[model samples]
Target: MATLEQCMTALEGFVGDLAARPALSGLDRTVSCRLTDLEQVVQGRLVNGTAQGMEAVPAGPSVPRADIRIITTSDDLLAVTSGELSFGSAWASGRVKLEAGLRDMLRLRALL
Candidate 1:
């Protein structure tokens, strides 16, 4: 299994790449991630530049932001990151849970 730090690094890289995508430009959003397996919470905003830590997650109009909460098992992270697991599947299987307003959830789906 990957260490929590390693998983965090991977997530950071994934977000960074997402931010760099042209289609994602000007998409600002905040996603609070809880890695149940790792027992960690990562909160950040999607922005133009890379974010290092929680504080660096952007929160501005250039990137409209919304908060997202994700709950999942440890092995689930690996599955999600590897594309072996889909968010819809995990949610349906009760492997992942999300708590938020309907609007926020929909916005998150688009941002993420």
Candidate 2:
């Protein structure tokens, strides 16, 4: 049971790394990360590859539609940050789900 704070810390680091990548420098998008196990969603807007306003949203179906969506369990989220699991592996194994448009997918190839 990973807390939202733990997930936010890990995600800030991940997004910060993505923001620093030259390959992602021109990318801008909004993202939603859903922790299904915890029934929580964190939303953020990315401008020039830097993420901002990342915070937990009230659990609901109605919210601003994100350009990218990431769905995963809270335990897996914790595992990835704790070095107990690899993101690529988890994604490949269907433990993590990433939904994005083709263009965004191409731009995000470097991170995912």
Candidate 3:
């Protein structure tokens, strides 16, 4: 498992990468990454091609679902963000799970 700080850093980099992509310029959505092993969630909103209000909170029923939800372990989160693991492969292997509306899924598939 990755430390909380490490996971936060990885997510920061992930958001930075997403923000740099022009294809996502018009995309606006709330995103949450649930770290299973750590039992925490990193929540934020992706707007204007950037992520805002990124924060980690304990995993529980009180954590509201976002427009885009990602569930995975902390180490896997780091690996995916760092390019050590491909998102598609991870999803296929059941290491990562993604949930979203059909339209959002289609739009995100092309960029994520």
Q: Output the number of the lDDT-best candidate.
A: 3
All-Cα superposition RMSD per candidate: 6.6, 1.5, 1.3
Q: For residues 1-112, could you state the per-residue lDDT of candidate 3 as single tens digits?
A: 7999999889977876775577667788888999999999999988887888999999999999999898999999999998999988999898999999998787778544
* Highest TM-score scorer: 3
| Model 1 pairs whose backbones collide | 28-63, 28-64, 29-65, 37-74
Q: In what order do the candidates fall by TM-score, top score first? A: 3, 2, 1
Which 10 consecutive residues of model 1 have the lowest summed lDDT?
Answer: 55-64
| lDDT-superior candidate, 2 or 3 | 3
TM-scores, each model vs. reference: 0.63, 0.89, 0.93
Candidate 2 local lDDT, 1-112, one digit each (tens): 8888889888776666666788778778888889898888888877786888899876686877799888898888778767789878888999988899998788778655
Ranking the candidates on lDDT from highest down gives: 3, 2, 1
Model 2 lDDT, residue 96, Cα: 87
Predict model 3's lDDT versus the native.
Answer: 0.87
- Show the colliding residue pairs in model 3: none
TM-score of candidate 1 against the unseen true structure: 0.63
